[model samples]
Target: MSVTDQHGNIFSIFNDLLKADYGIWLWEPYTEQLYFNSHYLTMLGYSNAEFPYNIATWKALLHPDDANNIVPMQFKIIGSAEYGESFDTRFRMKTKNGDYMWVLSRGFVVCRDEHGKAIRLAGIHIDTDTSEAIVNKLAIQHERMRFALDTARDGLWDWSPATGEVYFSPRYVEMCGYQPEEFPQRVESWIERVHPDDIEATVTKQLEFVNNPEMGDTFECVYRFLAADGSYKWILGRGKVTRRDAEGKAIRIVGLHTDITELRNTQESLAHLINHDTLTGLYSRFYFDEKSRQLKEKHYPLSIIYGDMDGLKLINDNLGHATGDTLLKTAASLILQGTRGSDIVARTGGDEFTLLLLNCSGNAANLILERIQAAIDIYNTTPDVLPVFISFGLVCANENNTSVNKLVSQADKNMMNTKLKNHPENLAIIRAWIEKRLGSEIDIADTRLAQVHSSS
Candidate 1:
């Protein structure tokens, strides 16, 4: 399948050109047998080459990009129930002199097995520029290009500004979930289907070249097109003024449409991953910092809260990391519930979280902290619930505070100070709970707890 549909049509076109070809060749797929007339070898500047050349030899002589294009069409014809389906394609063939010559190869499914699989193919190569077959060759080449475009599922648009008439290729209409006949053959029909937000930007670019043809012949833009499913899909649109008036106004504009929805969605998904925490669905540290910078520049008084789950390591070491992760999620939920919709909450690292509050005073920050603590208390009252607590630092900056780094430093220092006082007691309580819960199946070393406390 290296060569796709291209080689199939290429073979058919070349079959018609056999009337004025430079060389002839035959190949058997199953046996890998290959034959070429002396004129063929001489055409490729390989004079006096021995007989019995393998199909692989001929294939190896094909330009690398072309080999794949041929295989698809080759298999398509070979898989047919009928024989003698001709295909023609053009590709550069490597000559014995190491130079590449553009050769037109056409082949036919002359023989097929009982299973309808093509076994043998014979075709001719038209010279690069044969005077007698130039017209046929031109038409064939145009067909080849059209076939390739169809194979790619790309849509073409030809617009006549004066008449408001437009030709939308079948594939183009089909892509938008419309049957060719059902789709209007007018540019305005297309304009109506564009997403409202994107229509202005998309249409303006096209009109720029149409109104002032001197601006350029080509323009490309990405926009959303409404589909038949009532959904908008991303499309990369490219157009050029094919014909212009004597006064420099565009007459004909032709272009293509390529679906890029999947690509665009992938990019958006990656951006989300980069800016948000995977475990907590909160903003990531990078996002928080960037938001902080923006808020600072805009002269908003901001409160930065830095916190971490107390005894997180003790829970992980005693019960396993799974239990610890549950504790973290619970803490994140409580924190998110405590903050305003306008506030930004982020999981900066394992067991660590931050919150950004705009235009908030120190009292508002304390109120949010108190609300979070209340949530923790309510959860602790439930039977068999593991203890949840956070050691935190609250720092505030007004419009005049220009340095975010200093705010971060003061917040970290205050949170760590609270952690120093609160961690040991939290760890001890968690240890006792784990002992009773698990019947002392696990023991946590004080040294490890000390390392966790100091590291945080």
Candidate 2:
């Protein structure tokens, strides 16, 4: 029969069997002609009247990447009887909207010439773009997850409650100091390595989380793990319950373990630096303020002794800041030695120190001042280049009510008064003593006197 007559009969059969959801097409091999049913043209956002149904039009719509292989494969499959009477392939085809849609094309040779060369071919095209997009997206996601797990050196683990089976990635094996084959893939492998002291509580918490889905999907904890080196290392364990039973019990868990020993050590060092003075190794001003606030709420018998070095500027100006620093260090040591262990001593400023004496009255504070003086005298007798002298003022909290900050201010004012009264005379004596020892006249410009004159 003629090609048009053959197509009319084929269309009659398709009209009875094909649904509106499918796109049907026909091709004549000898003429290289193509025809698209109304559904096929409309599916591509075009009407049958608008689109020219021809081989050239169909080939132009094929995506460049798929055209080279799909076009050849389609012809080969129809021409060779040994291969198959029908063929199925997927490729991108352009839509009238100017975007490509994935199409699953299944074609069969419906007619053959006397020489057995296929004469008429028929096919149905189905839009599988959404499914293909989802599949490609999942493949990319899996590859990204693998790259992140490998490059971050993060250990990954999977646990199945039903089988009591555990899967450990290669990095997880190395994290625990074991080869992949050396470690058994069982839940107990991980449980056994948890430090004895922490395992019970950790497991208890894990069970609680599994039983209560409302708590959250995430589980995180920091605990010590026994390493292969026979030492305990701090680990930050993080995980999510990925699968759960109908009753909300966790059935599958995925997790990561990160070594956090260095991070923990850094945090502790930072805390220490925040609470103590780096130079004097004493409680810092920040710590002192916090302690004082706590003590103020109690209204206990507290005495604050505010002390200032008598000639620190003169020592720094004449001998150098190194000598001034030595003087400060010596004074700090003396204060620490004289104060009770329970007392809080802090270097609150460049030339000032404060001692917080708990459960101490004015009389007790006086005795502590005497002890500080005696300690300084002993230090001076040790043949030091510069004798250390500290002027002190002590104030006690009122029995009725007084804030610690108020007492601190009163004591500081008293200390300043005492310093102004005795500092000039004390400085002269110290300078003369230093000069006598060195057998020379040391010209030390008194910045304190200069400040007084300038202010006047």
Candidate 3:
């Protein structure tokens, strides 16, 4: 008294009643004839009166490639012993206007003869063209997305909160020094691999993303990942919540992981350049000033010693600038060796350097300066080059007397005095003597400028 379609869709009830109100098409096996519901005819862009209205009538509407398969499948169904069983097939249907569209035809036998054989078959047919079109379009889109992801060279990760499952693409596993199966499933598995120092903050920030959903997109940070070989590498992780539940909780997170090792190295190199002298690899004048200021603020007693290479200009002019550079580096080495580990020595200018000794008195400064001078004396004894020497001036600063500018000026004045004491002639006197001796050979810049002006 009741019958249902193959997919459990109800069709007819109470032997005399037709339950299907929508368009449906059926074929009578005994007569090899076809009947279409109004809706089924319209689905094929046709009306009952305009169509062939027969079994062969529907074949013309099928796509050329699908016609062979659909016909064979129909024949198989009709010849089978299960006469009340339905048949399903998908093929292109020709409309009244001659346009073809994809459609799925499915139905079950509803009528039988007294001999228990199917005399007529009846069932409901749905317009499955829209669904098939959607499926095909989605398949194309998925393939395009796969190609993009494969070629991008970026690591991708997805996590499902409800299932506690994490999915990583092949590239993502490669970034963390692991094969796909080696990756752990829980969030802690990821957190555990982060460097210890960054682990707590990184974990806390991630939890905050869950607590405040608005911050989910901001959960980007740099952390160290433990490599397969037990070395740690730097990577940057950036993510966004791709799916959320009805409760506003994040159900899925999708993100990228980039190797930022090179970036972090570049940052460190830049910082070193900012804080260090390029030539001698010592602290620069800028760093010297900053460190001194910090020491002063901390109320530490600071002793500064200023020193200059003796005859540096003479070495440059006579022996060449290369010799002069070597002399400067030699002097810096002696200064570094003579001072305590806590002391800071910096090359502030050409042939000029200073040392800041923490908790050092005038006596310690004098001793360190004498040691540097002695080291220079020994270096000067090398057979190929002339003997090199350095002159120094020492100044001690306490809470009452210390300011970076004042301390430097005081040491500089003393350095000049020491220079004069050693050579008995200041730079002015030496310059005058050189000019007197080389007067005829010298091309005076002032006279040259004057002559150029007159010519103009």
Candidate topping lDDT = 2
TM-score of each: 0.61, 0.52, 0.50
Predicted candidate 2 versus true structure: per-residue lDDT over 19-65, tens digit per residue: 43456676755445576666677678886555764577899999999
Candidate 3 lDDT tens digits, 1-456: 222222111111112222333345545554344655445666666655677545766677678899888777656555654532566556677777777776655555443333344444554445564566655553444344333323323465667777788866666677757875687656766777888988766767776675566664335567888877788877767666766777667777766565666557877898899888887888998898888767644545668888776566755664578867876776677778777787889999888898888888788788888877777667656654444556688888766455777887899768766765664333333334335545633222223224434665
Model 1, 1-456: lDDT tens digits are 111131222222233333223566656554454655546777788754333356667778888888898766676787885524677678898887788898877666554444566555666676766665674755565444334323334566778898888888766888878876668888877888888898678887677779996677666678999898889988877666768888888888776676777667877998999999887788998998788667644546678898877777778877899888888888888888788898889998788888888888888888998887788879888876788888889998776555777887788888878877877787777777888977865555546347657787
Model 3: residues with Cα > 4 Å off, grouped in runs: 1-153, 159-164, 176-178, 181-189, 200-217, 227-232, 239-254, 290-296, 358-386, 400-402, 423-456
Query: Model 1 off-target regions past 4 Å?
Result: 1-152, 204-209, 212-216, 244-249, 289-296, 358-363, 400-402, 441-456
lDDT of each: 0.72, 0.73, 0.63
What is candidate 1's TM-score against the reference? 0.61
- RMSD in order of candidates: 14.0, 21.9, 23.7
lDDT for predicted candidate 2 compared with the true structure: 0.73
Tell me the RMSD of model 2 versus the true structure. 21.9
Sort the candidates on TM-score, descending order. Answer: 1, 2, 3
Off by over 4 Å in 2: 1-152, 159-170, 176-207, 210-214, 223-234, 243-251, 262-275, 286-296, 299-302, 338-344, 357-375, 398-404, 417-429, 436-438, 443-456
